[model samples]
Target: MVLAAASHALSYFQAVVIGLLQGVTELFPISSLGHSVVIPKLLGWDSLAKAQSQSESFYLAFLVALHVGTAIALLVYFRKEWYGIIGGFFTSIAKRRIETPDERLAWLLVVATIPAGITGLLLEHELRTVFAKPLAAAVFLMVNGLMLLAGDRYRRRAEVRELVRTHASTESETEVGRRLDTLDFKESVAVGVAQIGALFAGISRSGITMIAGLARGLDHEDAARFSFLLATPIIFGAGLIKLPDLFGHLGNGVRGQSLVGAIAAAVAAYVAVRFLMSFFETRTLWPFGIYCLAFGGLCTLLFI
Candidate 1:
């Protein structure tokens, strides 16, 4: 049976807005999930918000489309890196030993992806059912802000800055995959484990993963690269699993809207990733942290 009320047909405009929001926020170290939940409520789109709270709602199916678009954008943006990584993965499997920097980085990504992949498989539904509400998401968004702030603060510690400065001066021109390959298996696992925190409605996968990478001594550029690389598979897999929903009864009335949304999401995501790669080259996470705090605080107050 269709879970979403028949009256709640998703409009094209809303689809575009939500899709753009998903694309940008998914990469910006701000919680895309949080924004998706909170924005509709703030706009008084009660039907859309109500649909999201339903387990088998059409909104959930729509989200699958958005995720697929975002994933595609990420894949395209990092095509060169992914090409090397995939080739390296297969070559290592054939050789039965990792030899190259690409091979090591590919395996490192697999190791780091395990914890979040497993956790998401088990807990994603339950967590969304329990805490996907606007009020709950707003609260968690504030917490996410604090996490980002803490990560930035940690990066600014005197010793940490000195260490990064020395490391950067020597390895400034190194390839990102090679730089990421320097992380040991244990550090990769730690970074992967940090992704679990993003299972919460307002916690950002990119934000927390980047924080973990920074904690492990990666510069902002490499940290962002790693976070995006790790997220590509996770996001794509999650969406692919639910892709059927978009073609089933759940998508009956919103197929056109979903298509438009997906395209908008793809465009927005490509632009966002391109901008962020440049932004992080010389910038820190302080701006994002502050934005999250302000936005989350305002939303929390409004919802309450």
Candidate 2:
């Protein structure tokens, strides 16, 4: 009873914090959702959890709604692009514009979504059980941070190599511009493969895929667009699977509280998305890397 009360006390704060984290961290190279899990786990969530025993898994429901909150934020923020992408799907073939990059961008989302969907389905139970361990989550958080650093380093290397190549070739500006859209199906697939690692480690789905996209020579903005687009399907799929559980637990005790938390999360996440878009435009990934490093190290110390 004492432990449950403490856990309940933590949930209110965790809601706002995690919502904000979800909003900002989702797009930032450091995984916000990953950090959400890792941070709480580090803070002795698991220990409290074990003391309580046979917990109703209402937290799982809370998490589902939290993602849904962020998903709504993304849809609201990107409504225009989504509208165009959806419209372009049926209209483009009729208009006979030979599969524009927008179309390919739409297709690339599918390419990237597939692997994670399969992987998540295969590993969901294992993840839920194992992710309860804060120390493991902390280690993964460190791994996730290194992955982001490595990605940024690799991207800079590629950009430098491309610049060198361009200087060597005396390439026309037009030709250089042409290279951005040039990533093929194979490269997109490779990025999808990069996404699988995100499931195990708390790497942002956006970060790893964006790295793969950068490696494939997509400019940062385009890579970001691809990353966000890839998220829509994965988010929707996960929500569907988790939604069934939400209702069974509804009104069972924590439902009202969880719903309240969901709304709080949604509102906070909306504001977060508003600011994060602008922030990413001007920022580098280094800050998020630093945050993950510090947070992960703290978690490791606490949990280990």
Candidate 3:
């Protein structure tokens, strides 16, 4: 059965609310999908959450448009990186060798995207069918929180151990620098594989990837950058795949609402990424983890 569109139709208010929520939560380590599902239920807009009709098609399209907005924001914000990747891609083809850091990083991103692409191709529909229940989403959100917390603890301990070793030696702190561009094939592949977890409704794409990066000893800032960069292809691809489905519903006012929602989503996502990049320079993911845990637990208690 198809899901009911938000409030039986894609109202402007619903569009903006869901758009803002998607933009903010999409990158905040909490599950945007979980919020998309739970928020409607909590607001007593159960009709909005039901998979019932062609209107549901519009809603899904609207969500995809929000993702497209988010992807666009990432692209705009990271245009420099994209430029390098593009140039390096061509250069590698022409030269028959990857020589520059950009070229190598481009290849790394390709390696990083492969696993997720494969995973989505193989399991997206299955997972969506099996785990679309709000209770399951809530439960997985808690799991996501626990994963974040555990990852943080593990990284902190690793950092402490590294600090001790550094202090014991003659090297200065400034001398211990990370080169994110120098990630080997193995590390890149690992990060890519870790991205598979995000297919779960409550699992976060950026959060899981950053955790994987931390495991590979990247600092938070660099890890966040890497995660955001890697997110572009997947997010954009998902949106594109859903765009055709939206066309049939465009005449029903879905088009205008989608435009507004996409704009709101883009602006919000740009602001969020800007803040998060600076924030992660010094802050840990603990706060977001705690929030997810509390929110998820509350959702579980109330809904399950």
Candidate 4:
């Protein structure tokens, strides 16, 4: 269905709500895509839900715009880091060697982004077609929660063992970055491969990536930082690829709504990332895990 015919279906209030949700959940390990699919259904916005399920629809275009906003927020938040990383990337190319931490990290992120980028290019449409429904999303959300819980448990155990063996204390930001920089290319590839799971509606890109990072011996804060860094390119690329939809016939009626939603998303994303960076500094993923489990379970029962 053309968005113009049903433009009124998505009111400004819904736009704001969904924008805020996208911003927050995109950063949180709670499966933003899953929530985007399920929440509309829960709210009885059948038109919006139906639009989301379609391969080419205004809702999907709107979502792409939201992703752009989220990506911008990440870019702004990590502006300093990006400046160094981008410079390091060029420097490494000029020198034909990777010696600095920023150079290594720049290369590492490239390696880690490849698998998911290729996978998304190859199978994104097929995967979304098969699993974008509320039922599938709900199931995957539960699985995501389980994965988070398992990852958290494993991290705790690993931390305890390390503490007993070496009495290491909490890691500062610099220490965390240094540790992340130490990751070999193989480990970076592993983290990247884990991101493939997020192609399914209910699996979180950040959540799965962070879990993989944790498995590679990164603490919570470091894992989160790496996940955010990795997400920046992917999110922006995806949005950029589909950005024409916002200006084409698909966006004919919803352009204004998209703009409003994008603004809300940007603001919400900045705040959410700020909060999460601080939260992860001294926290574990247990709370998010529990929240996902409970919410996913409840949604599953209600949907069924």
Q: Write model 4 residue lDDT over 18-81, tens digit each, in one string.
A: 9999999999999999999899999998888777778888788788889999999999999999
Q: Between prediction 2 and prediction 3, which has the larger lDDT?
A: 3
- TM-score of each candidate structure, all chains considered together: 0.93, 0.80, 0.89, 0.94
Highest lDDT against the true fold, candidate: 1
lDDT of 4 at 152: 75
Deviation in angstroms for 40 in model 1? 0.5
- Model 3 Cα displacement at 192 (Å)? 0.9
Q: Over the full model, what C-alpha lDDT does candidate 4 score relative to the true structure?
A: 0.87
Report the Cα RMSD per candidate: 2.7, 4.8, 3.9, 2.7
Residues 1-304 of candidate 2: C-alpha lDDT, one tens digit per residue: 6335534644666656655656566666676556666655545556333321223455666566667766776777788988877776666667766377566666656666787789888986676565644566677777777776776677667564574355322233222211433556677788888887777546677788877776665545556667777776787678767887666633244455555556666676567656655554545456666777787778788766
Q: Compared with the true structure, what per-residue lDDT tens digits does model 3 show for residues 279-299? A: 887788899889889988999
Ranking by lDDT: 1, 4, 3, 2
Candidate 4 collision pairs: none
TM-score of 4: 0.94
Q: Is candidate 1 or candidate 4 better by lDDT?
A: 1
- Candidate 1 per-residue lDDT over residues 1-304, each given as its tens digit: 2433442468889999999999999999999999888999999988887777677888898999999999999999999999999999999999999999899989999999999999999999999988889999999999999999999778767766555554423244432212566788998999999999998989999999999988777878889999999999999999999999998988877878888999999999999999999888877788889988999999999989
Better model by TM-score: candidate 1 vs candidate 3: 1
